[model samples]
Target chain A: MIPCAVTGIGQTRYAAKREDVSMPELVREAALRALDDAGLDFDGIDAVVMGKAPDMFEGVANPELFLAGALGAAGKPMFRVHTAGSVGGSTAIVAAHLVQSGVHKRVLTVAWEKQSESNAMWALSQKFPFQPPVAAGAGGYFAPIIRAYMRRSGAPEHIGWQVAVKDRRNALRNPLAHLHLPDIDLDMVKASPLLWDPIRYLETCPSSDGACAMVLSADVTGDRPPAWVHATAMRSEPMLFPGRDEVSPRAGAACAQELFEQAGKTPADVDCAEIYVPFSWYEPMWLENLGLAESGWRAVDAGRTALDGDLPINMSGGVLSSNPIGASGMIRFAEAARQVRGTADAHQVDRARLAMGHAYGGGSQFFATWLVGTEPPG
Target chain B: MRPVHIAGIGQIPNVRGDTDHDEVQLVQAVASAALAEAGLHKDDIGFFCSGSSDYVMGRPFSFTMAIDGVGLWPPKRESHVEMDGAWALYEAWVRLQHGDVDTALVYAYGKGHGAPVDGMLTAQLDPYYEAPLGPSPMALAALQARALIDAGRLTERDLAEVVAHARRLGATHPGVPAIDGPLDVDALLDAPYVATPLRAHDEAVRTDGATAIVLSVGGGGPRIGGIAHCIEPIELGLRDLTAATSVRRAAAWAGLEQAGSIDVAELHATYSPQAVLLRQVLGLADAVVDPSGGALVADTPFVTGLSRIAEAARAVQGGAVRALAHASGGPCLQHNLICLLEAR
Candidate 1:
């Protein structure tokens, strides 16, 4: 595969609502920022690849057609990728592949979701046959799994509270993050209302409207340092089958194995990670999934994933701090690239040389992950 | 781009409604057939990509259900697009160039009867401008056809001749409904206009179906010479509806200059007048068009584009040296994909 590098990154200020701007304007904010970051305009781009969670959230079908004008991508090759929440991550991977395939150079990839335009709760809750109706929303679907993880790991009840507080504090450092709870603590998280059993309102990710963009270029690194892409991987499986493990899906494990093998590196080489954690428990769940820690709860208790710890996670906050669903995964990817480029201001981890970005969706059956480094892999 | 081959192709016969089978069942039938035709099992595929629309099924995360049909066990690398399966095949072709992957499976399916297909399509227009007016696709195509007529590029008899050719071809296909006689231009002229300047036979038949194709690098199947897609802005009023700039751009990128000797061409022309416009853009006036009746006889939104490729590949397998296939999406042909194929 041809080597590709992330030369630029941009993201919008996530919030519960971005009423001031329309969907096209919301995405242009990130697209122009990324173009400026890369020191190039739309004229330099060869192609554009877009990703979003679902069209219903924004009430548009095949939005790339309508958005091409705003992107200045008329008469250019444009593609739309939809892989559920992991779409953001997969969109980047597809764009990178275009460069890797020697088919395009300087691909601009963007992902966003204006969830405030419609009720995402209702949009996601489509009743299908041969299924119980008890599972109401996304929170309702994952609550039982959190309980199962608590039982299986025998972890303390405060682990979720700790993650909520830690991420919220990290959000204060990230100006683009939606939540800036400087006074938040473990007590406040535990005191919050329990929307789903074992999952508190504070422990859940807010419905945010935002976008993320990046410029992926083929082996033509200008003067600025590039975050060399070491590996990219995606995995999918049936959401419901005979022996499917929703809590610790084999798809995620298989995806991580392929990603590391492609990069020719292991978890120990990773300086930091930006794993998707829409809910607090996912921090621990995905940690174990990525083979970073033997037990996620134990690592949380030991502060091994803190800002100054052995392997800091979500240094620019994470999905828990700000999630626009579709753009959440790309934000993880962009944050990882930022860390390697030495551009993650205020939340920078010292001496960070290697990082991982991870995202999964659709009952944990779809997974996309990538490994990046400051120095090109041998 | 790295060279890729279309090793096998499969498609369900186009029908107005496949009422008994669901989306997964429809997809599984074609996917299994495709893999079987390639002499491979499901495990041999390195990547899986699909294209589908949520509005077709009237729900969210609709394409995820297609995994059941392909047997997503032991986990597999996969991605999807909300467009047509031709776009999915384009993604697979790109993935096959990564050197790590050798073979890929691409498929697309749509349920046309669950919702008012025409009304749902109107929603695909610019939401703030065109969609608010609720102008049906036929209405938009009629407007385009009117422009073609005024420009003297097409006429009522020209459209009737196109329909006559499609009906003649449809008669040969066993499953497709036969358009019984009275096949003269006068008969076509007698049919009432569904949309102004577009008779009932002028518009494509809205059908439900699915298609699957296997793509491999340095392996069996018809070799893909070039595949590319381009798009135009959805601002319909500002753009030239008479000519498909997107198709012209995609064809040029897909090596249309070298396609001078194409033996066969399959076009995704949902309306008769579109066939006229696309033929000019592709410059295939001398080549045989729509040997398998094209989309006019049966049009399944997501599947039609991919089936064109399948049909063109079948022609190449039947000894045609070179073939071209095309697919379009969005309102007034806002997006276009063109693929060039040659026999191995």
Candidate 2:
């Protein structure tokens, strides 16, 4: 396989509502920034790939067709991917494959969501014929799974509150994060309103409008250092079946195992990671699923996931600090790329040589992951 | 890069409405048939990809539920695209080039008959300018047809001839309804217009269906010669509606000139004018076009594009040496993909 590298990364300022720009303009902002970062223009790109959660959220089907011109994709190969919340990571993986497959040299990938236009909750909770109604939103659906993890691990409730406080506090270092709570504490998080049983309102992700973009190339380009892609993998299973493990899903573990095997690295070699944690409790659950932690709750208790720990995670504040649904996964991937490139600024992990980005969606069925390093893969 | 081949193809008969089966069953039937034809079990396949739309199912994450039909006990490497299944095939082809995966399964389905498909298509248009005006797909096709007529490239009688030819061939394909006796061009010309310059027969007969194709490396099937796709500007005013420049570009990139003497060409032209336009653009005068009736007979939304490739493969299986297949997306052919296949 051909080697691929990430030379440029761009992100829009995450907010509850980006009413100032239209959908096309919103995506163009990130694309242009990424192009500028790469020290290239639209003419340098050979293809464009885009991903988003659903069309119902923005009232437009196949929005890529409409935004082709805005992204400077005219007279070029254009592709669109949609795999639910994990779509952002899948989009990045697809773009990298285009380079890795020798199909194209330079590929521009983007993922965005404008939740302000329509209610995502209503769209997700719609009743369909001959099917049970999904009256509860995503949080309501995942609350039981979190409870199951608590019972199985015999962990205390403070772990969720601790993660909520940690991510929000980290958001203070990220200027683009939507929620910059300077005084976030465990007591404050625990006292917040309880939307779902065992899931507090402060532990939930916000509905924000944002976009993320990256420029991938087959070889190193531009004056800046590149984060070489070591390996990428995606795995999926049935959403609901008898005896399926909803917590610590097998698909997630398999995906991570394949990714590490391809890269010829182990969990101990990873300097930091950016895993999708829309709700605070997911941080611990994914740690165990990815095999990064033998006991997830114990790791949180010992602050191993903190900024100064042996394995720092979500240094750029994660989905909890800024959630755009579609762009959230790519944000995690881009942040990991930034860490390996030593461009993460205040949130940078010390001597970060290797990093991992992970995302999962669709009732914990779909999974996408990638590993990047400061040095090229052998 | 490794050589990719279409090992097997399977599709259900297209119908106006399929009330008996849901999306999961539709996927399971075609997937099982394709895998059986390839003599491979689900465990042998290394990668899986699907293409579908949320609007068709009236729910988000619709593709998530569809994976249940594939039966994921040990799980598999998979992905999904919001575009047509032809693009899914393209991604799978790229994956095969990575040299890690050997076989991939690609499938797509759409329930177009359950909703007002034409009205729903307007949502794909520009929300700020075109969608609010609410021009259905036929109206947009009429604008292109008028452009061709005004350019002196075609006449109303010529479109009637295209429709007559499609209906006659469509009768032989199981996916479409059989025509009664012979089709009359004069009768087609006399029919009232659904939109100006476009009679009811000029448009496609929308149906609900599913299609699956198994692609493998170093397999006993038609080998993929070259495949490429390109996109033009989205705005209708920004492009020359009378000409399909993107198709010309894609065909050139797919090595149309190198694939000497094409025997069959299956095109995803949902409207009569598009068929006429593509033939001229791709220079397929000597090739047999749409032997399986084409999309004008029975268009199944997302499934139609992949079905075009499947039909072209069937032509190769029937002793054709070389064949060309085309798949399109967006109104007025905003995006186009071309695939060339040959017998090994």
CA lDDT, candidate 1, residue B324: 96
Q: Model 1 lDDT vs. the true structure?
A: 0.88
Residue B238, candidate 2: alpha-carbon lDDT: 97
- TM-scores of all models? 0.98, 0.99
What CA RMSD would you report for each candidate? 1.6, 1.1
Residue pairs whose backbone atoms clash in candidate 1: B7-B221
Point out the worst 10-residue segment of candidate 2 chain A by lDDT.
A128-137
Q: How would you encode candidate 1's per-residue C-alpha lDDT over A1-378 as one tens digit per residue? A: 678899878899999999999988999999999888888889999999999998888888778888988887898999999999899999999998998778998899999999999989878776755546845578988888899899999989899998888888888899999998888999899999999999999999999999999999985544568898999999999988886778788999999999999988998899999999988998888889889888998898888888888989999889999999999999999999999999999998898899999988888889999998998766
TM-score of chain A, predicted model 1, versus the true chain A, to 2 decimals: 0.97
lDDT score of residue B157 within candidate 1: 85
Query: Can you list the residue pairs that collide in candidate 2?
Result: none
Interface RMSD of each: 1.2, 0.9
Best by DockQ: 2
